[model samples]
Target: MDAMQMALPIVGIVAAAAVTFYAVSFAEIREKSFEDLEDKDFESGGFKPSFSSRQRRARRKADKEGRK
Candidate 1:
């Protein structure tokens, strides 16, 4: 077989795999959206920040006792 003919199928397989990966990723994100809406962490006013976003936790600097 010609080199071009052999290469074309390989390219097509890679393209198909990429399309499938994206489709599954989007589906999982959509499912997570519904779960987030049902979460109990929301504040009375609005959604609460995730644990990692809290003021104390998000601070990167050392505390007064630890500072030089």
Candidate 2:
């Protein structure tokens, strides 16, 4: 029941908490798959479809609007 014994357990618990926190963060950072990165880049940059495909889509939309 002395202060030394009391302090030992507290120190151990704190150390365990710090180690666990670091390990989880490391695993999370490592878990970012390449596919996930590509998806993020595509989302951030907006969709970059081929120019021909985009022009076709625009024409189709215009045609639909003209008939409306």
RMSD (Å) per prediction: 7.2, 8.7
Tell me how far the alpha carbon of residue 51 in candidate 1 is from the true structure, in angstroms, after superposition.
32
Question: Which tens-of-lDDT digit does each residue in 1-68 have in candidate 2?
Answer: 89999999999999999999999988887677644655765656755556698889999999999999
The TM-score between candidate 2 and the true structure equals 0.49
Best by lDDT: 2
lDDT of 1 by residue, 1-68 (tens): 89999999999999999999999999999999978777756667656655464656546444644675
lDDT of 2 at 60: 94
Off by over 4 Å in 2: 33-68
Worst 10 residues of 2 by lDDT: 34-43
Cα displacement (Å) at residue 37, model 1: 0.9
What is each predicted model's overall lDDT from 0 to 1? 0.80, 0.83
Candidate 1 lDDT? 0.80
